[model samples]
Target chain A: MIAASFGAGGMNMLDSQSRDLIVGHGSHRYKVDVHWGRLDPGRVPVKDCHEMAVDSQGRIVLLTNHIRNNIIIYSKKGKLLQSWGTEYPGAHGLTLMNEGGEDMLYITDTERHEVIKTTIDGRVLMVLPYPAEVDAYEDASQYLPTETAIAANGDIYIADGYGQQCILHYNARGELLNAFGGKGIEEDKFENAHGICIDTRSGKPELLITARQQNKLKRFSPEGKWLANIDLPGAYICRPVIKGEHVYLATIWSGDGAENTGFISILDKNNRLISAPGGNQPIYHQGNLSPMYQQLQLFKHPHDVCIDEDENLYVAQWNAGHLYPFKLIRI
Target chain B: MKAKHRGHSSILFLQKIALAVCSIVALWGCSTNKTFSQENDIRLSAPIPQYSSTLFEDSFCLSFAPGYPNSHIHFTTDGNMPSRKSAIFTGKQCFTQSIHLKAISFHPHLQASEMVEIDFLQVKRLEKVKAISLLQEPSDSYPGGGASSLFDLQKGSLNFREKAWMGFDEKVVEIQLEFEKPQKLSQLSLSTLQDHGSWIFLPEKMEVISQDGSVLSQWPIPQLAEAKRLAYLHVSLDEIETQSLRIRITNADVIPDWHPGAGHRPWLFIDEVILK
Candidate 1:
């Protein structure tokens, strides 16, 4: 790493370098590094890097829609390790779960309207097709799953964000258990339910679903009953990635829903926003969050953020000129 | 004494030359690190503007996005392009008359951003209108307050999902406005939005007809480059006197082939209609 002093004369030189750019608010500052995961586009092309996750061996695995190579694995120090898979034309979401001391992957393909379970090395374990058991879906074409959350008991919860806007629950054997939450503006219904994850911070596993277009995160019981709602005005959040006591999300758009306005949002244990990396400082007045907007042009259309064991952040973008993931080294 | 003074003056001149050389070397080092390619890659984004409405009766407050360190926002009110020498916007400004505003952002080490322009119109209240009704209804998804929305004097943002915009997918839309008596009118302005990402476009053609079904005036919109923003189309009426008028709007039958939604029906959105 190159470090330079920003004296009276060399201010312009230090301003242009990305290594010296530190972002985020109090207690969560980070130094941005744009050249962390850059690779040759001709050899390994990427089209809309959607999501990322870290495996058991501490490898960063990224998912893209490019049919050439859908999954690209990298080391923590920005080295290309391996790549695999080509069948997922619409590979949107990637979820990693440790089962029986082995890491398993859940890939959601929007074009195929299904979810597939695979081992870390790209071996298919099981496939869950469209939920014909649900009455809201007339056929398989109406169920376009975007994300999935696996429970401790091997149960699966899928969010059909593009199609019927319903959350489908299934057992470990790929059998449908319960389905709820259709498309509407009501408190129980959802609008653009793009992501889902299980939050265990409260000692009980509750479903946290992303209502992206409405800029809200809804909480539901394990049996699909509405619990509460967290309102984030002007933030079009994508997914909920839970760490030890905080929740990190990638906001796709903010401030009047304009294009190419994105930021990273971090919430504390009490579910209140604490820091926003590329946005304004989080301010609350009488237990309500003020509207948030992009203050710095650091990211465009950020889709997901993966936090490593050291609390560093890896951000993946969509429709940002096919750029690679940017790394935020914790300061 | 003269020789000693000359020697001291020469020493001072030499020291000034050395300092000048050092300053030049420092500037050259900074230039080498900041290449032209790198400057082009990280251009600053245009500032986002906020206002209560584009059409106001008396006045409105215009504000910009939040600020950051080492960046400045400059603006102009006469429709000229904004430059670094323009007025710096410190906070929200109140305007009392119609004006065309343009703004741009600049940073220390990055290229300047493109200009953002908006037009705010000062309108007069019309009390001669009696009843207004829509002959053709809008889409079910975007009702937008029904027929009263056209005369509500409110404007919608770029997000078409907002309730102020009335979206129509039909080929032809007709609206009837009846006055208590015949009134003289010279111009008509309609506020619309064009957000290609959401598949919303402006109307193709507009016509004003008298009570006898005779065309009084017409305006045909010309095809232009694709842009995502709001617009105001002004139509000249020639000061014709009429009690009842029918305003007809035509939508594009098929979207252009270059768009993502090619060969599909284009949506037309209108928020408010004004008569002067």
Candidate 2:
């Protein structure tokens, strides 16, 4: 596996089959994720980050849980860039894309019960308010969007993380294509699909989705197939980001507030843990630190992550208002 | 000679004084028709500025006047945020007809505010509630799946728990709800663990029995593919009201290949059975 680094510069054509590590770290200052999700043990609650996306500029975007209104941006060096959006009272997962020639943001507000698309500047571009056909919800605060994945055609895959709890498919133009994925525990099905990724790990583009509660990763063809389910571990194993030969994920081990400590695990193509990213660090478990001796250099509650051509890591931290970015070097 | 010089100078001074008086009179007379008037101070206290309510086609527009003509007024319906567009005042209704004028005030930066707020509006049909789920159960039954629950709540009476239904082979769940009267239902919504379609289910058995243990109706045999998992079910609430209606489904079929026979045991999840 390539060694990991935290900063700057290089250009080498890399293959999609290369090995890489997803490093992680958490801080005590910028944990604006929730009341219990602060950095210090007196405040921060437990929240593992989930579903992340990389911008064209190589920045990372993160979405936190336990009372949405969580969003954070960061540079490759893990510097907190700009962060806003504590509006999703019931927020779950988040994804980013380019719309009007810029890194556009799409967030699923499970509480407000709507899907919002905005510019990086936080201007509301389009609001695909609650869809009508899905038998989702009629109440204002019931439509919960857990995660979102983009298709090449701009179609959006919305994981109904909470509320109606289903996978909703929409066209790039924000039209309802088809709505699937609901409450179940099956190989071809999902119990709680907390994470989703549309990757080309296969020769062709396919949907590499993770069912958090099921501890399984299922890949589907673009048309939505029950292709296969790979195994993963942890109680609340969340969204999966498919890198070269490995798939990265976040798993929650403790509390429910911002201070809750989480672990990040990497799985090979066969879905086996290569190494746990934040598993070695001191997690703020119930006031004192939960002593994990692994000493992973930099990570905590890695809810979501992404890899670029340069092997840089862009992670969206859980309970953090900002994203932490690192790079996998020649270690 | 002295007298003549004094007279000429005095005459010139008097002429200058007369011209100044004439100009002053002209300025004073120009203020008559202008009332600071046209009720420029007339302002509205309702129908907030940026608020929008699509409750009606031709909604009522609350307006104000007698105040600043175009001094920049701002308001909110959904609170704090005004609509994107800016509207000018004809002094009669600068906002829209639908705004309840819940609250209005001159934008603070524009100087003063003669604010007005209307009481909660009678929002004739303010919002339309399409469906309401009666079941709200959370499930972590599947390993390696998601945090999403097995089913959502809806306007039904049969919840999976009350129906003795969990899940089945191919992970398909058969749902059946019973009521007292016959209801015309054109559509039925069922949510699988990771899916959201297919209403008709293969039945090993479909029988509706009354509280007296009498069979009210026996569902016909059918062939429907086994579903991924049963999430939520939706059927119209337009019929009978049997306090206790038993819906039995067993020996289910997975695919809609052959007609579903009364063979294998099927799952029965009745979330909310509503009878009209």
Give the top-scoring candidate (TM-score). Answer: 1
Candidate 1 residue-wise lDDT, A217-307, digit = tens? 9999989999999999988999999989999999999888887789999999989999988887899999999998887668999999999
lDDT of 2 by residue, A288-318 (tens): 3332222221344556556655554444455
- What RMSD does each model have against the real structure? 8.4, 27.1
Candidate 1 runs further than 4 Å off: A1-19, A40-43, A77-79, B1-45, B109-114, B130-143, B168-176, B196-205, B210-227, B248-267
Top-lDDT structure, candidate number:
1
Tens-place lDDT digits, model 2, residues B1-276:
999999999999999997777667534322222311112211211122222321223444444322322334454554332321324333444333424232233421122222333222222221222222222222333121111121222211111222223333333222233423433332232332211122224333334443434332223433233222222223332333333433333334543345233343333333222222
- Docking level of model 1: incorrect
TM-score of model 1 vs. true structure: 0.82
CA displacement after TM-score superposition, residue B111 of candidate 2 (Å): 63
Identify the runs in model 2 with alpha carbons over 4 angstroms from their true place. A1-52, A63-71, A99-101, A136-142, A254-261, A278-300, A308-330, B1-276
